[model samples]
Target chain A: MVQLDDLDRAILKLLKQDARLTISELAERLNRPESTIHFRIKKLIEKGVIDRYTIILGEPLKPKSVVAVYIETEIPVIEDFLEKYINHITKTLSMLPNVLAVARSGRNGIIALIGGETEEQIEKFVDDTIRTLPSLRKVEVFPFTNIVKGEDVIGFLVDV
Target chain B: MVQLDDLDRAILKLLKQDARLTISELAERLNRPESTIHFRIKKLIEKGVIDRYTIILGEPLKPKSVVAVYIETEIPVIEDFLEKYINHITKTLSMLPNVLAVARSGRNGIIALIGGETEEQIEKFVDDTIRTLPSLRKVEVFPFTNIVKGEDVIGFLVDV
Candidate 1:
């Protein structure tokens, strides 16, 4: 269990905003020696504090992160929807091969967000899957056109 | 903006799992002295990397972070939805206060995951407002009972 001191908390907060800062730069900014900064970072990794680094890959590109969207079905459908359905849906969407995350939906119907390299591919994925899911009475598919606050921004950092 | 070095990222990753770690304890675990660890943390703070410290508040007792929810509406509705409607929506949900984030559904609706204090508040918010919005035809609401992978966990040293 890691109990964050103010400094640790601060370091985390900064990175939450931007994740590419250098140690010497951080050291200079912190008025500390480069060695001190470097070692502190090394410690953080050994403790499993930092996870892996990732790149945000969309710029009018292959659809987006929510390649696989979840169509929300009403509560009445939960009985029909099962864990097996997840793998099944993933495989089903695999036909299109572009969708990313497919969970359940929130409201009345099963929702699936299409993700693909081209507009044509995305359209086909939605069409094929619409016929596949039987329990689905009405399917409302929404393609992501733009990003507001992405899934990546949601964090749990503590300020110093 | 917070830029994370390898260490800062590690610290964030570890803390997400367990936030009760002590300075010296972290130092020992990470193989650095407490002082150096302390310095980087300080820099992180001054840089505004860390946001704020908050308790998870437990899933069983507290309102969990909301995940799956899709609001199905019409896109032409966004023009009006963005005006008095969207701002009010943001204000109302923000007032209810548990909602972590809200996104435009891309289609006609807004998709969001709400972390409500109680089920009643969430249900009431949707039900009461449903009929009021003329453009909103079928407002489907789903309360998230489980989390696939915590969005907060992917975050690093800053509060990610």
Candidate 2:
């Protein structure tokens, strides 16, 4: 586990909320010296604790509807073929703009977060693009009606 | 829909990768004047196309294991009670630090992203925290073995 003192955790929390904060601003907010704030941030970055700085696109760019799709591929006679097929599915889904995130679940299952302008549009995408794929056992779709926490994730992961 | 020109998208794409890029750097990369880059960025922010700036934590802070949990609550005789129960469940789940994201899947269902040190720990958390909740009809856990796209989301959403 990473050893993070209260000061380090405080800085991290502030940065997570707003990465654009200047050293001086952080110093003032955290009641620390500017030099100390600068040094700590530099050390954090050097230690790989601060991975990257990025922007989250707002509503103008975000999809109106989002869904989580779980896909389970049928186990074929050749085990090797299943591995290759799963890789292919993940890679193919990753390239699509609407497919916000993709991950392998267990051995034969895959999970994806998809976004679209409307529920019907996302459903159509699943039917035409996902369901049509060969050698699948089951595909379950979970629609997100209201996001209670981490709602900004859609904005964070949306494509330009 | 908000209208965005190619230059706006180009700038957004670059910023998404690295928000710390100076206006001059963006201008050099996009082959535009620094003043123009500055003006465009200002306009984008004013229009709310560019949301807030944020940081993604590195591996040291990210949970080693993540799982997507789908929870469905049993509908009660009173529809009013169902709404309150769903709200209570989502709010409770959202309060937990390990529950990275929570969203209402439907009237009676919820989907949450959970993280922990190991898969066994996460499963134990689910068993102790989630399954014990009253009026739950089903609780499904999908362990993420490999994340092919938007993997940084764990880093982005993980709490300090």
TM-score of each: 0.52, 0.98
Q: lDDT of all predictions, in order shown? A: 0.48, 0.95
The reply for model 2, stretches above 4 Å from the true place, is none
What stretches of model 1 exceed 4 Å from their correct place? A32-48, A58-61, A64-86, A94-96, A104-112, A117-123, A151-160, B1-65, B72-84, B87-101, B106-108, B114-139, B143-159
The DockQ for candidate 2, computed on C-alphas, is 0.88
DockQ of the candidate models in sequence: 0.10, 0.88
Tens-digit per-residue lDDT, B71-124, candidate 2 = 999999999999999999899999999999999997899999999999999999
lDDT of 1: 0.48
True contacts kept of 1: 0.09
What is the TM-score (0 to 1) of candidate 2?
0.98
Identify the candidate with maximal TM-score. 2
Write model 1 residue lDDT over A23-110, tens digit each, in one string: 7777777677888777766665556565443222212222333432445322454655554554455456434434443333333333
